[model samples]
Target: MDFTYSEEQQMLADSLRRFIDTEYTFEARRKSARQGESLDRGVWNKLAEMGVLGLTVPADFGGFGEGAASQLVVQRELGRGLVLEPVTPSGVMAAAVLSAHGSDAQKQEWLPAIASGERIVTLAYLEPTTRYRPESARASAERSGDGYVISGTKSVVWHGAAADAYLLTARVSGSNEIALFLVPRDSKGLGVTAYPTIDGLRAADLSLQNVAVPASALVGQPADGLAALGVGLEHGIAALCAEGAGAMEKLIQITGEYLGTRQQFGKPLASFQALQHRMADMLVQKELALSMAYVAAQALDETDPAARRRMLSAAKVTVARAGRFVGQQAVQLHGGMGMTDELSVGDYFKRLTMLDQLLGDSDYHLQRFGEVMEA
Candidate 1:
């Protein structure tokens, strides 16, 4: 039950941080943003080469054979660097979902490609009306002769436009049971509209009109999809919380440096008592959020499902609040220049705002926490 990161985990985090600092600087990130892609293929390949993409994939699948802690380290560094890569959406969430529930053949077919960064997959769970509710999917997969015909529209599919495939959630026709289906990007009757998001990331709206797939495409049993989704979502939320903690830490550092150098009223801003107190408060919030993130990461496979859910929800809520507070304060403290395109501070704020809405918002997760408590 020790909450501290192991030596190996710390090393991995440090290495990733150094790599990002050297290769994914603000200028390079801005350049990629201008080009309309969230990540550079070269950089992504480099990450794969470094074994980052394979951190959480099992060793039997040609991966690092690490666990949730290793993935958390990578996610934290990615957030600190303001990376726009689809690693989390594709590499973590989609990969985890498949690893958790996919059949042996499915694992052998996809996990290696994903681990090697040769294929990208994204979860297409959100619908226009379903909002963040995975269970509310209106998409249907009807049984055909020896396969299934899927018809539905998925909105806000992260990196869906560029993904090699999709891990889709759809309702079965007769049983009303939800199921996960692996649909290739080039499959017939699949349409996609890709665009940039506020956080300088790529997303797409997916239209599946009778997209047919073999019965083997189904992940696990149809009745197990919802439960499997919950597991995947837990991992996703924990990853976001870790990312939010890193971003909050970066915000604090940036603001501290700015206050030390920027003078106001003929003195350095950091010399002011009020600003110092505010920064202290920000640090407190960051520490609490960080602690929660670590707890949630370690609680990933806890015996008590309720404990796991509570820890994950608590971490997410804490991180969301900290992200919003730190982001807004960083911008406000930076004054007029903070909101301009020329400043990294502005980009950080935008990214944090977007993270607040991802997985589930603070309010949404808070209610979930309550539900878990009652249960």
Candidate 2:
């Protein structure tokens, strides 16, 4: 399959890059990080005006009527900019989930606002002990008079505190089956505590004490909640791989420029043959990672389960390895300044570290890859 970006996609990327460079510098990111809040409303509105927030929403819902590839392009640019916006949660995860499983009424109610970036939504799937398995959720939604009462705690929900609504995953009463509920953030008995992550992104812990929602809130078949979650997970992994590839590219570029200008023993550090070889290695790893990311993005719609598993696992593993290598090498080449917050390289390192852990780490994907091969 052809992986070359279309002209429109390239133009979109260039526009986003230009805007981010001019308006969202590392200093701006640092200020936001220190503020310990969700993204600034003004910047988010600008993104909406740029049409990025609606890249994936269907046109009928006031979106651009794009697909996963378009979303991937936007995410890659966000990564390159070191942006702290909650694009993955709101754009990819929540939007994709709603598009795939929401009833017509549910779609009409939520999609327009979400597509316009007037509303932010987040996924509440992780439990205290669930680790990386969406199916391991123990949160229960019990049938009540005219609706369901949900009681559980969700850990590390991306943008949970600032979200207008939550896409909650819970088990149905008396069964291992799973379901998703669209619970408003201000619902009665819902408690939220949010903070900035080490990488400067917002995350929250949610406590639902018998929070209730009408049956219309449920997305997809109750028993097929796990399946819907799986689709979201796959898309998430693909987007992450693309983001990692972009990070790796930035790391390589920044390190190269630093070496070219920094002097060692009366000569530029880039004059060293050994360092050149290392940079070459970083480039190779980044290229391979990009290839895997593209393949995984295309494979997300594959009909065969085994093929999907294999491609996604491969993409994750490739990204993890390349991300680690690029981050470590960038730090090493930059000497002491690489670890300091004043430098963008250090922030890149932290962001890449968080990406390494999100969804699944390197070892996790490696094991999954082995399993696919064994089967």
Candidate 3:
């Protein structure tokens, strides 16, 4: 199979790359990060104008992409800049959930806002007890007259504090089935504690006590919601894989540059045969991760759910391992300066570390991959 990007895909990638280069300078990013919002609305709006925020939204709702291919391309670009925006969560994850499970009216209302970057939406799936899967969720939604009352806390909601709305995951009353609801951020009995993540992005701890929503807030069927959640996660992992690839590439670039500039023992560090071997290994890992990212993106369109999960798990494992190796080598090569926050090398290292923890780590997915193979 040909691995080259289509003209449209290449165009989208080039457009995004140029935007990152010209607008997302390290200093600008450093400033925004210091202010506590890893993402600026102005930047997000520009991304929206570029049609990147709606890459996965259904065309009926004003989105354009070929499966997950285009998204992978955009994600790679965003990753290169260590972008703070919650693009994958809001645009890819939320959009995937809405398109796959929402009512037509719901779609009409939310998709346009998201596409235009007029509103931000985030998915709150993991509870403190939740481990990538919602199996440990203690969050519950009890049925009421024409409505449901949500009562539980969600931990580490991606961009939750800044989002206009949250797609909450709850266990339906008296059943093991999963239920999803769209809760407005200003809803009564809702609270949030926003904090900076290790990677400079913001995440929130959400508190919900008797927060109520109309039955119309329900997304898809209770039984089917869990399945849809899986699909959303698969899309998220694909985006993460691509982003991880881009970050890995950047780490390789930065390390290579650092070695060239930093002199050691009366000669350039790049001249050391040992370090040269290390840099070569970093490049190989990055390329391997990129190839797996490509596979994960394409696998999203697979007809069989089992097959899709297997591929995503495998790719996640590959990306995680490669990411860890690249991050460590990058930091080690840079020495003490690499660990300092002032430099981008350490920041990239932090992002890579967090990426491993998010959406399940390498060991978690490796086990999942084994489970799939067993079945």
The top-ranked prediction according to lDDT is 3
In model 2, which range of ten residues has the least summed lDDT?
356-365
TM-score of 2: 0.97
- Deviation (Å) of 14 in candidate 2: 0.9
Clashing pairs in 1: none
Off by over 4 Å in 1: none
Q: Please estimate how well model 3 matches the true structure, expressed as its whole-model Cα lDDT.
A: 0.88
Which residue runs does candidate 2 get wrong by more than 4 Å? none
Across 282-329, the per-residue lDDT of candidate 3 in tens digits comes to: 999999999999989978888898899899999998998899899999
Clashing pairs in model 2, backbone N/Cα/C closer than 3 A = none
230-294 per-residue lDDT for model 1 (tens digits): 77788788788788888888888998999999999899999999899989988998898888888
TM-score of each: 0.97, 0.97, 0.97
The CA lDDT of each predicted structure is 0.86, 0.86, 0.88
TM-score of 3: 0.97
TM-score, predicted candidate 1 vs. hidden true structure: 0.97
lDDT of 2 at 123: 87
